[model samples]
Target: MRLELLYFFFYSMTVYILETNGWPQQGKHELRWNHSYTGINKPSNPIDKEVLEEFYHSTAGPAWLNNAHWLSGDPCESKWYGVGCNPSGDVVELDLSNNLLAGELPDRLSNMKNLEVLILRHNAISGTISPLLFTMKALRVIDLSYNKLSGSFPPQIELPFLTNLSLSNNQLEGYLPNHWNCLNLEVISISSNMLQGVLPNGLSTLSSLKYFDVSENFFIGPFPKEYSSLTSLETMWLFTNRFNNSIIPESWNKLVKMKNFQADSLAGNLPELIGVNWSDLEVLIVVDGHLTGDIPESFCHLKKLKYLHLFRNSLSGPLPKCFCDLPTSSLVSINLSYNQITGTVPDCFDNFRDLRYFYMENNNLTGTLPRSLSACKHLYTIDVSNNYLVGSIPSLYANLKDTLNWFELDNNRLNEIEDGLEDFIVTLSTKFCSLYGNPWSCPLPNYFSGKEYCTARCSSCNTLEQHSSCEKCLTSTSNCGWCADGRNCLEGYTNGPYYPYHCDQSEWVFGNKTNC
Candidate 1:
């Protein structure tokens, strides 16, 4: 029996076969990865060294990407580089947005099938999307915005789990996909595309789609009646299309969930707000459309209305007294640019305290600028250009102090600058003001030259290096706070040399000077 046992043991040792243990370690040389790695702190493969290596190599190489330490296969933190992980050693999220990676996406991306969220926005990646991608079954969010991706989206696409897909600012062409049964897709943005042809009727069946933007496309004809079924739709931006010949569907009033509703160029008048349930509507923007007739009187029902943008349309009539009262109660912005509305800005505008932005430029409203406008205490942005209104500037800043950040009263009949116009000088001294086009006296006001305008305005030379719009700060939610050092909050904004410039006690002059 001893001889038989010895022989069997020797045979087993010679075979050297062992069952695979989970990702912890593979002997001393082979490391295990993809363990819970805390799901985020480690690679999911649980047994590979190349995961982090590939991550840093491919993702624009952010500063924190260098500090990542690997304890076996797990990383230590996600806020370091927008990395997320699942229970296994797999990387489930990678959001290296606006990190400015240059060049085309590498084809080796097929390796990350476990990724659920992939945000690679504001980079300079050029080239068509790779067909060699992993089926990406787990991908829920994909934001490749402001990149240089061109070519038609793959027809046989297989991303069933995708929810938020923002492919804006890319050069993608071809008609929008006609059929998609993706029940889970919520936000799909293909704005600023060259896509042509009518939307397929089947698209309206995507009841779960909350935000669908096909703006700036070549789509023509009436929006199909089926669009009314999208009861869950919240933000529907269908502007700048060739649908001017189409009738504004009366069923549009059913978009009760619509908040940021924008649909311009559909020929017709707005329906009366009596039966319309725009009660939850915050932003009612319809610009450059063919809608004519007076501003809807029933619009006063929107107690929640904040922004009312009705620019570049043929709509006529005086501002309704009720409309002024409600917007004053709740609205922050009111734009009626490029319209034929005549008569004075409702004197009731004086009651608006939340009014931040007010633009009635290029309208035929004939009268002196209302002195009551000065009463909107929170007024920060104002543009009343190209109008027939004549008066010395209302001197609203005397009351606002410094809350007035943006003020444009250009191309009006105002013949003189304000007495305290030098205060605007302080704005030009820093980097937060724009004033021009109003006729000023020869012995030019105070600080801020026309050259200052030339320098301060985002010139063609500086725009490439700098963001033209607020996009730089807008992309990041917590950026650009004036109370704290703006340099600390925003990357490009600087008041002084970098220590990242924390707004110390010295930056504040409290007693009488408030930091508005």
Candidate 2:
């Protein structure tokens, strides 16, 4: 057959000289307008066009694509910069995101065989990521996130119609690929990578996963007990990693369409009906986790909770006074600082009328301070510092002295401060009141400015003169003029030279100063 037609004409002229741009013959390749796609060449394969001119002449992609518009024309009919083509000329989408495109990352782009979307995000694209790009099976969205890409990560992910897989902040390390079935995966972010081992179970067969982030990465054990049955999981970020798991997998209550669950140092307890299956949870962070019991009163059935971080942890009883009788109208910020919580303080701010940040600082809480929190007219911040509180300081915070900004009642056992809220702490100008270890009385240094009015041991107990020599004497060098069942009369001590002066009339002076 005439030598089989001369070996089929030398294999179609060596595949048409490796598909155009004059195959590796070095130099002399100017094609700016000698252009000719043969009348709009409808090529359904065969126009590798030297795979994007050898990926714009080996990497640095002509400094962000425009080398005179990609060496002039026909990159699938001239529309480049984030190229996308189809109608037979192939090359389906390649968004060079944040296009400051630096070097590396050009494994002939897996020869674009109908490539379906490969966004090089925030490019500065460094090396290592070409495992022939998961053999591109018409890849569906593979974002090389925040590039600076290093090695590892492509052990096996066959990309069967892949759905949004972002190699987050790359520097990607090993582990992870146990074969993510890729069954139409739905959003998988390898967050801040430096990825370590464990986390494989082929990702519980990604049943159409809905946002899964391996946060901050260094991923260690625990987390993949079939990922709480992934019922189309809805946003899960395993924070900071090194996951020394203590427990959070009670089959995660079969994730009833979970809505944002953050984790780091996750320890036990917290599953007490977790708001009856996370009633469409809206941001629940488990901080410094090692969480212990009591916080559940079914979390008042999370009516779409709006940000509730369980601070520090070792949680104890008393904060579920129906959690302010829930229906908190979409509560915003309620951090329970350092736990071991005990009773009182829940006057239920008239059901937190859209309350803003209220942390129960260092718990063991005890009564008085909740004058129904002035019905939270968008209360700013009120931290109950070192608990065991007692009355006064809540003159309805003078209607939240214009959106009160942090009022931390330092070391409690509080005693008097209300001369009707002392002009809400002398006209607040960016409030921050922390009455150090209370015993009150000491606001008159020209009524505020600096330490806001107390502490220097309440300004040396306001130059002493009975207010129990500086608020019911408890060391300012104890003038202890009676009260602890020495039969009252210690409201700011009186009887001329303090002593058995048991002057009770509910003794709480320091302003109208009488009955001593």
All-Cα superposition RMSD per candidate = 23.1, 22.2
TM per model? 0.64, 0.35
lDDT by residue for model 1 over 68-114, one digit each (tens)? 44333344333234566665656776666656665667665656767
**lDDT for each residue of candidate 2 in 410-509, tens digit (9 for 90 to 100):** 7765656665765667555346777666544444334554544534135334333534343344344333433432222232443321321223335433
TM-score of 1: 0.64
Provide the global lDDT of candidate 2 against the true structure.
0.67
- Among all windows of 10 consecutive residues in model 2, the one with the lowest summed lDDT is 24-33
* Least accurate 10 contiguous residues by lDDT in model 1: 19-28
Largest lDDT belongs to which candidate? Answer: 2
